[model samples]
Target: MFTGIVEATGEVTALDLRGGDVRLRIRANSLDLSKIQLGDSIATNGVCLTVASLLEDGYESDVSSETLSVTSVSSWHIGTKVNLERALTIDTRLGGHLVLGHVDGIGEVVHLNPDARSWCLRICAPNELAKYIAQKGSITVDGTSLTVNKVEGAEFELNIVPHTLEHTGIGSYQAGSLVNLEVDVIARYVERLLLGDSAANT
Candidate 1:
């Protein structure tokens, strides 16, 4: 599990797709890898990948075929900047909402404009996933947790502050960019519990 808080930005040093699978190598800039061991999980661009090997400055992980089909990881190229976050520990702070590092669906940036002191980004979520998103709700975009500023059908808006822009890869986003998106975990469960009836009807 993760808190969806990006610790650092990592660069894709290598991406090799071979024989029905993929090998991803990332150079985690300013990210501490000293305590990271093989088999530890790392959240890269909202995808939870296991650390297959330890590198001098980063690590390597294998992206299975399933992950490729469901996520935007397949489109990642060398030099791509990705949000990086370590797995949550028992003692870690819940600075952001609980995130499983599981990409429910991919979204496309439809609009990006500057707000007063921040950027307003509007993304089109997949039809199936859009119903789960709500205004003022939490969503993880490319591994960075953020609040939804507004929601209109399949499109949701976000206010990206300078700090968020600088700390994560969101700063590099533009119109038509594909991003890994994970909806709030709590919302999913709530919907399941109230699948057939409203909360008041319960």
Candidate 2:
């Protein structure tokens, strides 16, 4: 599990699609290597990936073909910046929400407005996912936890502060760019329960 709090921004160094999985390599900083070991879980762009190998300044992981077919991690190109966060520990605080690091779907940036101090980003998501995203609710974009400023039809808005723009990759996003999106897990459970009841009649 993860809190969705981004610890560092890592750039893609290698991306090789193996037989049934993709080998991903990224270089990072601000995360201690000594504290990490093989088989450790790391959140990369909102996806929980186990560390297959460790290095002095980077690590590598393999994403199964199933994950690649359903998630946006497979669409990333080399040199792309990705949000990185270590798995939540028992002693760690829930700075954000309880994120499973499981991406539900992919969204696209529809608009980006740079303001005096912050930025207003609007992203378009699927109807099924948009229903769970409410105003003031928490959403994880490429592993960086953010609050929904406004919930509009299929497109929601975000107020990105300067700190976030500098710390994560939200600042480099352009119109029509694809991003990994994860909705709140609690909302998903609620939807599932309600849907199950509605389906009982048929």
Candidate 3:
């Protein structure tokens, strides 16, 4: 599990396509990898990927075809900047909401405007995932946890402060940009519970 708090920003160094899957490497920037062992999980741009191999300055992970089909990873190229966060430990602080690093769907940035020292970002979520989002609720975007400022049907707005923008890849986002989105895990559980017996059938 993760807290959706980005520790550092990393860069995609290389990508090797293997038939239907991919083997990619990322430079860890300032994130500490000394304690990271092979098979440890890292949240790379909201996707929980297992460490296939450790590199001198980064690590490599294999991306399954299903992951690429459901995520924006298919658009990644060399030099792509990504949000990075190591798995949370039992002693780690819950600074953000609990995140599984399992992206539900890809969202598209529809609007981005400056709001004082911060920025207001509007993204359109997939119709199926819209029910999970609520105004003032938490949502993970590109691996960074943010509060929903507003919600309109399948669209929602977020306020990104300068600190978050500077520290994460959100600073580079623009209209039409694709982003990974993970709705609050609690919401999903609550929904399932509300469904009662019908939930099992589905």
Q: Summarize candidate 1's per-residue lDDT along 23-134 as a digit string, tens digits.
A: 9999998999988999999999999999999999999999999999999998999999999999998999999999999899999999889999899999999999988899
Kindly report which residue stretches of model 3 are placed more than 4 angstroms away from their true locations once superposed.
Answer: none
Q: After superposition, how far is residue 74 of candidate 2 from its true place, in Å?
A: 2.0
In model 1, the runs with Cα more than 4 Å from the true position are 196-202
- TM-score for all models, in order of appearance: 0.95, 0.93, 0.98
**Lowest-lDDT window of 10 residues in candidate 1?**
193-202
CA lDDT of 7 in candidate 2? 86
In model 1, how large is the Cα lDDT of residue 172?
89
Model 3 RMSD vs true structure: 0.7
Candidate 2 per-residue lDDT over residues 61-123, each given as its tens digit:
999988887678778889988888999889999998988988888899999998779999999
Candidate 3 clash pair list: none
Ranking by TM-score: 3, 1, 2
State candidate 2's TM-score. 0.93
lDDT of all predictions: 0.94, 0.87, 0.97
Best by TM-score: 3
lDDT (10s digit) by residue, model 3, range 137-182: 9999999999999999999999999999999999899999999999
Clashes of 3: 0
Judged by whole-model lDDT over C-alpha atoms, candidate 2 comes out at 0.87
Residue 93 in candidate 3 has what lDDT?
100
